[model samples]
Target chain A: MAPRKQQEIFDATLRLVAEKGYDGLTVEGVAECSGVNKTTIYRWWPSKAALLGAALIEADVLGFDPPDTGSLRGDLVSLVEAVTRLLTERPSGDIAVAALAAAVRHPELDAHRFFADRFAREREIFERAVRRGELKESADPMLIVDMLAGAVWMRAVFRGLRVTDDFADAAVAALLDGI
Target chain B: MAPRKQQEIFDATLRLVAEKGYDGLTVEGVAECSGVNKTTIYRWWPSKAALLGAALIEADVLGFDPPDTGSLRGDLVSLVEAVTRLLTERPSGDIAVAALAAAVRHPELDAHRFFADRFAREREIFERAVRRGELKESADPMLIVDMLAGAVWMRAVFRGLRVTDDFADAAVAALLDGI
Candidate 1:
């Protein structure tokens, strides 16, 4: 397959997965949507999970380049806000839930690595915060990241609540100052 | 169908969903596993999503009754600990992820209500805490609940980290004392 064709196939995978969810997605559907041959897709990606994972990375479905806004609070809020936007503004949440379910059912898929890599970049804000003395040096960066992101996910995804700007501000405040 | 038959079918549905995930599970498979006919299952549950919801409730997949441990801290730890046990000790996490993905794919199934009811019981601890004057009267009980549960889920479910008793205590402290 040509480089351009491979990219087209990945783009098609993202569109199909986002629209149909992972289970409803098929190699044939990708072939149809991308105008690429099924044999070629199979030759490049052995399974639907593989195809989806590559598509996620290549398309930057959950990617974020956290901006350094000088203040830890500012940077953390932006990082979390980006997550909220991905989960709420786009079809990324559906794709994530689909991948999560698929990852649980098929352990070989290793979706955790994909998310962990993406989330690690967001964690850099905390490290910068500590250096700037915004947060206690002893604070655990991973825990802080987990708590902030987890709360957003719980409300927005699991509980089906809107991730409003007010909610984002409250989350950041609660994380910074004890509730 | 007899009451005993209904229980058996639900049990079978849980077993199949936990084992196979929702996408791979079929009404025919449940009937074969339970030794009940597919027609009977359809009569009881209009769809696979409905059947899985009922099975989840009957199986107590995310069920919890937290004991009021006098302090908000104590109760919160216990509630999170129970969530940890459910997600880690059993195949309940797989069931939850399965349902989450299914709910996303089929909006009419209303898995949110199913989880809302189960999670509402866990929220009672926070209510008790507010009543005891352990937490501020103005605190948003729902947000508190979301943060606590979300942190545990991020680590235990998303990060695939061990939700140790120590980790549970730390999570409660962080929520109470701010990060």
Candidate 2:
């Protein structure tokens, strides 16, 4: 089967898992939802964990659109806005928040790699900013990324705080000052 | 039932839930862990969710034994160190992280109020410094606190980063210099 077919099946499976807890998702359900065969699903992923994990890593949950703005500050503003937009948009943010909550319960077989693309992107963004001299040379990209993303995640998942342009500005400014 | 007894039962439940996911926990399990009667467990807290939420809030997971050091930088250093110590202490952090994870999936019933402490203490520290004139009057305490805790939590929970004194200092320095 083409990888696009695999992507289609994975997308459907994510929606199923997000809507219905992981326990509620099934290969049959995914196949039924996506018009893909169960055999095709199994052939690509050894377990449901693998299938879902791959989707989170590859699928743009945040669609984490990277900023090409001339400076790190602009990049940060752009990133926060995108993140705020993603969280405000239905289903994507809900799925992500739900998935993170679920990941802890099944730490042994979490459907997403805690160490994959998302984390990597965070590091890369900060490092790139440093390279561009957008931030101080001493700034640790990893820590900066963690602070920015962490605040957003905490607000969305814990406080259920709505993101606003003012919020985005404060958070970006905090990053500017805190960095 | 004494509130203290209720507190103990809740503590036991939290540890149990952390060590053994929600599926593995029970009222009887908490009773066994805390040496309280099964009757008392239900008497004070009607549901596991209520018990857990109360325990999570009262346990002071984010409590900081700040050193009251004279300087804002020093105070923040002390705060970060305390946070790191708490995170590394054991089942407390583990259970706190676990409960938060669970809360996301079961949002309706889960009202983990860890952020209440986080934000409160955060504002207190920054505002105190502002009053002392150690920090800019314009400094946003909420933003500062978010940046500090956000960096630590993101590293500890998401990235599995072993937060060290060095990391904390770097974070503090980054924030101080940025401002």
Candidate 3:
């Protein structure tokens, strides 16, 4: 499929998910919304889970390139801000929440794989921090990432709280400097 | 209604949510499973969300008493362990996931109320820590609690990771001592 065609499908998938959630999303709906034939969509992605997963990955919805800010604090703040945007922004935020809710009911969706892939990509920031001697080599990268992201999830996703402008900076400072 | 009868209804609600997720849960199924009349259930609860919310609250599914462990680290470790058990244990864990998923689709469920109540109760631990001079008075209690509980949610609920015995201690240490 052409890149533009794939983008259209991905956009439709995200839009549908944002509007009606994952359970309401269907390949037929995607085809109708995207103007793509069902046959072609099935030929490329076998299942609804596959289609949604591909849309998320191809759209770079959950993954972000680790920023090289030359300092651990700067890099972490950037990463946290990226997560804040992902969870607080439209389409992406709604799609992420829908995906997470769907994952609870359908383990076959393999939400863990998406998180794992994103975590792997994001680990580079921590690795560089350790190499730069800014972080201890023994620091658990997964824990750090999880705490930061999970705090955002709690505030922005779980409680539906308005994330303030200082949230990213404050979160990074708390994690790095201790509360 | 008798205490035993209320317990049965709550139990049925939780069990159904565990087996079939929240969307699959219904008052009729709960009534049938619990041997309680649907009319009687509705008279008291009024709606499915109300019934589920009552069950969660009356059963203390999400709320835990703040541990008075004499020190900040001890209290935080205890709090983390409580959250770990809530997310990792049967019935409660499954019910929590189902309710959270349902909350995303149905904002009327007021999942935030449950979390808010839980957080409000848990804040006492931090208050006590400040009184004991173990934590700074300027510490953001919500952020501290959110980070600790959020980390456990990330490990146990999100990633479905096996929480080791040392997880609570390690998480608390990381938060208090900085990563």
Candidate 4:
């Protein structure tokens, strides 16, 4: 299938997942919603889980590595802003939620590892901050990253609020300074 | 059914919801797991959503109201610690994730409202802190609460980390003074 057509299928898959949750999504449903042939979808991917995983990767939903801005705060703010935009500006957040739910339900899936790797990569920003003496030596980079990202995710995804730049700034400030 | 037995049924419901996504869970499964009569469950709850909602309420998963501690940091520390304990000390987090997924997949469900009310109640702690002049008058209580709770939830729930008292203290310090 053409890349554009593949994108359409992914878009449809995410849309359905967003609207129906992961359990409600199916290959037939994706084909129907995307106007793509079911056989074509199967030709590319073997199962629903594989299709969903591929769609997530193709959509770059969980992919991010914000460039360092020479300061921890700047990097975090930029990174969070990008994440906020990614989760809120499109169907990526829904895709992520579906993937998370699916991972929990089906422990055999690789989606858990994929997200864990993404989170580990996210922690590197904080690791850099610690190395630059921008953070306390005792600070757990993983915890700090979790707190910052968690705040954004909770507000935007769970609480259904628009994650403003000001919120991101405050979050980074809280992480760097205390609150 | 006896209240104590009702608790067992609720426990079973949550356990199944946690292990299987909401879509994979069924009332029959819950009945089989709990050894409760299906008719008895049906008598108390009208639908699967209702059953799940009741199970959550009975489990008291998101239920908590941190008392005033004369300072914003103290109050937040207490609040986040309690939330951490709630999500970590038991299977409540999985139940919560299941309910969240169900709510998202089924828009008509009342789980969203239930959690929204819980979040609103959580905001009250910040409201009290602001009233006591421990926090800035300009502070958005909702955002503050979101960040604080988000950090804990993200760590204990999503990342599957044990949220220690020390970490909670640091979170509060960051929120109060800036990290």
Query: Among these predicted structures, which one has the highest lDDT?
Result: 3
What total of clashing residue pairs does each candidate reach?
Answer: 0, 0, 0, 10
Ranking by lDDT: 3, 1, 4, 2
> How do the residues A19-133 of candidate 2 rate in per-residue lDDT, one tens digit apiece?
9877777788988999987887888877777777777676644356567777677777777676666656776776676566666665644533644566666565677777876
lDDT, candidate 3, residue A9?
A: 93
The residue pairs in collision within model 3 are none
Query: Chain A only: TM-score of every candidate?
Result: 0.86, 0.87, 0.94, 0.74
Better of 2 and 4 by lDDT: 4
Task: List clashing residue pairs in candidate 2.
Answer: none
Candidate 4: DockQ? 0.44
Q: Which stretches of candidate 2 lie above 4 Å from their native place?
A: A60-62, A108-115, A122-132, B60-67
RMSD of each: 3.0, 2.7, 1.5, 4.6
Candidate 3, residue A122: the lDDT equals 84
lDDT of 1 by residue, A9-121 (tens): 87778777777666678999999999988998899889888888777666654556876999977777876787788777756776676666566656666677766776677
| Candidates' chain B TM-scores in the order shown | 0.86, 0.85, 0.94, 0.77
Off by over 4 Å in 3: A60-63, B60-63
Error of 2 at B35 (Å): 3.4
Please state what fraction of the native interface contacts candidate 3 reproduces: 0.64
Cα lDDT for residue A144, candidate 4: 60
True-contact fraction per candidate equals: 0.58, 0.55, 0.64, 0.47
Score residue A160 of candidate 2 by CA lDDT. Answer: 71
Where's the lowest-lDDT run of ten residues in candidate 3 chain B?
B55-64
